[model samples]
Every structure is written in C-alpha cells, then in structure tokens.
Target: MFANALVSFEQMVSSYPGPLMLVTILCPDPHFKKRHHKRRVVQKPLVDSILKNLHPGGQVFLQSDVLEVALDMRNQFDSHFDVLEHITDIDPSVLCDNEGWLLINPMGVRTEREIHAEFEGAKVYRRMYQRRI
Candidate 1:
C-alpha cells in the first residue's frame, strides 16, 4: 500500500498500463479536525488521478461510517465523473428513510473496520460511481 495516495498516484497509474477496472476506498480515516483535514485520503487530486487512470465504465467504490466523509466522497465523484448509479442491498426501513446515501455494502467483501463498525451499531454509508467519457 502507498503511504500517500497523492504522491504515489502518478507512479501507480503509470506502472499499470492497462486501464484500471475498479478502485475501492473503504472506511478511510476522516481526520475530523479542520487542521488535519488536508491529511484525509479522499481529495480532489487523488480523485482526479483515479478518474484519469480508470477505464471508461469502470467503477469506484467508497464507504465510510462518517456521513460527512461519505457525502464529501459523493460530491467529489459527482463533480469529476458521471454517476451511473448507486448500489444498495439493504432494506429501506433500516436506513431510516434516508434516500440520499447508499444503505448496503456494494463490495461483497467487508473490511475488518466495517465489520467492527456494524458490531458497534454504526451506520455505514456507501457510494459507487462510474467513469464515463
């Protein structure tokens, strides 16, 4: 794993000549403090680089327990990429009638953090966006 996504993005993309089919960012550190916000993983430059390397119709999956962080990711994708759809496999009632965010885990595989969050009874928001020329 790269220590810094922004710094390593160029090299990572160049190393793989073939178009990337999918990129997943799950439960990233929110860096809640305003002063540390810059350290957050999902930023414009990284998002732009991901879009640049992603193949057309390829999808990007993002999930976070923090609603603010999840919405920030959605805004980034909406601004830079064409959002094809939002994937969910959960009951509407469980989400408390919130239609703005995804309720289910799109990626079948769950990260350790996600599993723990669920055990703690935390709400996890997810979003899936497609890159289109």
Candidate 2:
C-alpha cells in the first residue's frame, strides 16, 4: 500500500491537479499486535504529504474500529488540524439523507469480517473525524 501511495504521489505531482483531498483510513486487526501498528495506513509521512497537498478548506476524513488507532489518529490530527466533528458527537439530524431520511448500511454490503462479526453478534465501534478547513 505504501509503495502504491508513493507511485500515486509521483503521478499526481507530475500531473499537478488543482488540489487534493486525501482521506487516510486505518483499522489494524487485533492480531496485528502493538509493534505492527506501524504497518497501518495512517502515519506521519502520509499525514504530512496529505496536508501539503490539500488546499485551504479541503478536508480529510479517517475512521478506525480499533480504539487505540482511533485515539492515536485523534491525537495526531488534533496537533495539525482542528477537529470539525467526531462521529460520537454528531447530531442525528446532520447524518440524514437528502430526503431527510436516516440511512443504515445493511449487512449485505459489509466486508467479510463485518459479515462474520454480524453472524457472531459482535458489536462494532466506529469513529469519524474531519480535518479543519
């Protein structure tokens, strides 16, 4: 993934788009263990490049089911950008659809792990945050 990003970065720079809005999502499985957190997608280099590319008011969103990853992301982002909203704090009204409908993603569209967890009746946690404009 990192190699792919490096290649993409090179391509983007060569093409020179108007601006970039990058979102880095990280969710390391439990088996990844403490030392392997470095393997996760969200890291200092990625964040720095993203910030450099993003135009003023451009936002970045990240999500993770792992508590530690979420917390670490929160801390890292807080240092560089103001927190616009946290998923836990979002008002239900803001999450509604264009027709003022509340939407829920059904299990049918879930990832393999999500499907397994649903069958096992396990609870899943999610966090969302956006970078400052």
Candidate 3:
C-alpha cells in the first residue's frame, strides 16, 4: 500500500518482518528556496530512522540532479551512517571518495528525470552507504 514516506518510514521500518536489503531515494525535491529548504525530505530524523531500521549490511542508494541537494544527502548519511564505497562495475572515476560524494550515477539505470537532465547536460550526484554491524 502507498504511504507517506516522510511520516511513515520509521513505522514501516519498525514493522517490517525482515531486514531491508536495499533502500533507494532518487531525485528528492530540492526545495531551492531558502525558506523552504527546511521542508526537504532528506534530513537528520529520516536518516536516523533509516539507520535504525537497516540491517547491518543493508545498502542505501541516494541520487539527485541538484548538486547541493546531493551534498546535503551525503552530509545526512555521513553524520548518521558509515558511508560505503562504490561497489558497482562502473568506472572508478564515478565512485565516491573518502567524503562519500559520487560524481557519477553508480546504479547504471537512469531514472526518467536523470535521463532528461543528462540530455540537457546536467550533473547528477550520487552516494551509497551500508549499515555497519
């Protein structure tokens, strides 16, 4: 069933029967306006909830066409979770460094928005993390 992820993510995580193996958040609204930035979806509370619900080795994949928003997502994960290095077969140049900021799309599969952005020559940032034991 559909649920408001922002409000129900924690509950869903808690009630889930088994460990969540993978979580992907793609193209979250940037909320560009300074006044609306606070309303962005990727925040400390949600990150915390994800961490708590994640299995020790579960993976979290996040991507955004907006560099600033991607960086914010990285910051949120860095603060709460031990960011993981890129494990894809893609070019190493696209992988995240010690700071966990990916310069390319590691998933290989592009979202519709991502494809459109790429067609317009937009830069997308991505990050991946694994829950530590």
**Residue ranges of candidate 1 with Cα displaced over 4 Å:** 81-97
lDDT tens readout by residue for model 1, 9-107: 768776987878888999999989999989888898898788778887787888898888988888887776343443332223423225566656757
As for candidate 1, its clashing pairs are none
lDDT of 3 by residue, 63-122 (tens): 888988988887777676244433442335455655556766657788998898889998
Candidate 2 lDDT by residue in tens digits, 1-133:
3445533654554366576544535344543577877765666776677767666545555434454665676576657735344332344533534422223321124555545655777543333444444
Steric overlap count per candidate: 0, 0, 0
114, model 3: CA deviation in Å? 0.9
Spell out the clash pairs found in candidate 2: none
Residue 46: error of model 2 in Å? 0.9
Q: Where in model 2 is the C-alpha error above 4 Å?
A: 1-3, 6-16, 22-31, 82-133
Q: Sorted on TM-score, highest at the top, how do the candidates line up? A: 1, 3, 2
How large an RMSD does model 1 have?
3.9
- Give the true-structure RMSD of model 2: 6.5
